[model samples]
Target: MAGRVVRPRQLAFALSHTESLTRDNFLEGPSNETALALIDSWPDWPNRIMLLSGPEGSGKSHLATIWAEQAGARAISAHSLIDTMVPDTLVTGALVIEDLIPGTFDERALFHLMNMAREDEAYVLITARVAPASFAIPLRDLNSRLRAVPVVTVAAPDDQLFRALIVKLCSDRQMTVDESLVSYLATRIERSVAAARRVVAELDAESLRLRRPVTRALAVEVLRDSA
Candidate 1:
């Protein structure tokens, strides 16, 4: 699955986690502990550039934000990378450009940004579901730079992240459920971030239609329907 691409909704599902970028809330497990460590080892980055790659709902954006805040990095999207002097305007040496689509990115601007970052000993962190190798960057120099940058990937949500996601998604809707219910969902639901969010949203609608409280029974029925 090298250089794989995914849908936008898949990436947005990553953002379904709590809005807080506090490091304390970032759950650590075998799955993402390495990626977290790489971020924690920042400023000491080999090339002062890092690429945070992960599947949708893998919490890459959240981790990027945490790193950005700590390193005083300016954050922007790949789409906005072009048509603006955003990169040149960055006062700090650190930059975070997310959602890096290969063909769509502004080759010149991104190339300049990366070049400047290297020359100034600044840092850049990019987040995306797609691999940098998969991007069709036109600028030869930019392509070479991205190819050499470190791409630390966060794996799909682990069991701990799944359970945490269930709680987070429910909390987003102000719905309460027992731990047992969350555990049940963590086991039964699809092992993807999109599944976590979609199920929670569906549960709300299902409960409303049935005029019932969200319960193990309701979840069972909802999952069945979704299946």
Candidate 2:
């Protein structure tokens, strides 16, 4: 039987579902090993309060979501934390805040929320691309408090890890790729997981459009235009 053609929205949903957060879905490598170890030690942590920080596409948010699933923790986006009061939004266990370094001016509220979570003996994990020190935080108290929390940074992936990530992403998308092609991309594309991911996504979309399998030629063409 012929498989049904995936519409754009359907493809989007499929990709989202396949890439949904789990420790297994997170590609393990030297760069992220420390963060994974820290997350794995979550069971031993007295305060589930942890912070994961790294460059873009370093999988900080992905690991945060894994932490939530493993500990039955609540994951909340940054926008929600700003627009809504903490007590009103989070009434129970752990909470995660993503993108805490950029325009994160609502420090007083976050400071109070941290105390509340501590009082309740619940965990709070904040994930960001950069460390809190890089932000323009005016609250001295909050700055000191945030600094005390253990922060784990995900280093950029190396060539091997990048190749593995590309293959994993393609597999998750149910797309077949040749090893030689992955090798070509690993050497040619930008040296960031974010770049590899974007290239794969573009190739996937292009393949769907042209009804062709992704090859070295196609990859090169797509990357050149995008780069």
Candidate 3:
């Protein structure tokens, strides 16, 4: 015991992964077919203004990116909306306002942007966790405009899509997971893309620290520890 030499444990570093948001990278399933169709419809949209809604990590941003690429749209955050920026924001004749929340952004700026887009026949794509129609916007005209805009909602992932998402998330982290681990995670975790991303990230970090391969046993440990 006196001669025992203890090796230092490995340090798990947090590295950033750039996820591909291109059209080819998006996974299609029943949950998102309608949303995909809406993007593909493009200029033929029911209205020049459209609202894209979904739960977090439900691929709303991804679909928005695809549409933006096709439409040459400029992307902006809802919080950054300003009355004076409305005209310049739509220079490309298209815009994407991401992560819009009620009461967080300038209601007047949005109202002005909507009117400007309508006047110029520009396309505006708004992404939010919930539909804008459901938001309690104080601006009466803005509320009416948002309610009239066509809404496309992305639902939660199905079984096949869930498994595919787990695989994709793991691959994004450069972790090679087999079916057993995938199946185990699918049943054990919440059925959402965000949940899959979180669990896979945790497992990867844990495996690196422990110097162990990712497997069902490792998954059990990670899941339990997180719980």
- lDDT scores in order: 0.79, 0.79, 0.92
Better of 1 and 2 by TM-score: 2
Q: Which sections of candidate 3 miss by over 4 Å? A: 1-9
lDDT of 1 by residue, 9-110 (tens): 311122343445567767676678888998898877766788888888777877888898899888889877864575464668788888887777788888
What tens-digit string does per-residue lDDT give for candidate 2 at 125-144? 88888776666667788788
Residue 158, model 2: Cα distance from true site in angstroms: 1.6
Candidate that scores best on lDDT:
3
- What is candidate 3's lDDT per residue for 135-171, written digit by digit as tens? 9987899899888888899999999999998988888
Candidate 3 at 85: error in angstroms? 1.6
lDDT-wise, the better of 1 and 3 is 3
TM-score of each: 0.81, 0.87, 0.94
